[model samples]
Target: MMFKDWLKNKTTQLFFVLWLHISLLNLFFVNKRGIVFLWQNNSELNTLLTHFVTALTATLFYIAIIKIRLRLAEKKLTLGNNVFVFGSAVMLALIGFFLF
Candidate 1:
């Protein structure tokens, strides 16, 4: 696919946004420098491990959101339904935040 068309895709946009969100969360909250610190320190193993964990975490979150979105899309749209989905996403994110 062309880059422009790829960027226009909902799935692509969602993935990009979620990846950026998780990355920022790690940078400011979880790691406080994160990959930069590892790079500066030249800790190859730590850097690779960090990258793997970040990508894994992002993928897990993406899957969770996508599954929830798909399930919700099957039902009639309603404010309550929207709220439930939002709440579920927040709860899942919190679980990841605390667990990690």
Candidate 2:
């Protein structure tokens, strides 16, 4: 399906939100341990690469979340939409803080 058309579907919206939430959570925990391990081991190249990859992935996720929020905003805001958008925003913001 077209991206815009896919976004308009309620099932797609819910699925996107759920998937994003799980992925972000997994990324945060896994990255945290990996980064700490790398830091302690003092591997400069590996540490830098880890940070770069983490930042890149997080930035892509951030952009996708923004797109979802914008598309949802075009419709009347329902409780479901509010929860999904705001929850994702809060999670993304927390992850941003954790990263930097």
Candidate 3:
């Protein structure tokens, strides 16, 4: 199915929310441990690579969430979009700093 057409489906929209929520929860816990471990241990390229992979996943999930929400409603902006984006980004940023 085409991307925009798929987003029009309510089930697909729900899936986006589910993916976003699950990703966020996983990120919260995973990043908590990962960040702590990175800080306590000597930083290595492999370890940093793992964090980058996670960050990439979380970012993609967030983007999907935003795109689905906007496209489903056929609007430009919606309430609370900034809140979701900012909150997730901040959490990721915290994890990112420790990764490097």
Winning model by lDDT: 1
What tens-digit string does per-residue lDDT give for candidate 3 at 1-100?
A: 7876764565455545655554444343355446422243324556545555655566667668777877968966565878879978998998899899
Question: Which ranges of candidate 2 are over 4 A from the true structure?
Answer: 1-43, 77-100
Ranking 1 against 3 by TM-score, winner = 1
- lDDT comparing candidate 3 with the true structure: 0.60
**Residue lDDT tens for model 2, 1-98:** 79767645644555456545544444433454463222343335665466556555655676687677787688855457788799889999998999
Structure candidate 2, residue pairs in collision: none
Instruction: Please give, for residues 1-100, the per-residue lDDT of candidate 1 as tens digits.
Output: 7955863475556655765664455443234555442234333567446655666666666668667776778885435678879988999999899899
The residue pairs found clashing in candidate 1 are none
Candidate 2 Cα deviation (angstroms), residue 31: 21
Residue 25 in model 2: lDDT: 45
Q: Candidates' TM-scores?
A: 0.41, 0.37, 0.35
lDDT of each: 0.62, 0.60, 0.60
* Between candidates 1 and 2, the TM-score winner: 1
Clashes counted in candidate 2 amount to 0
Alpha carbon lDDT at 89, candidate 2: 99
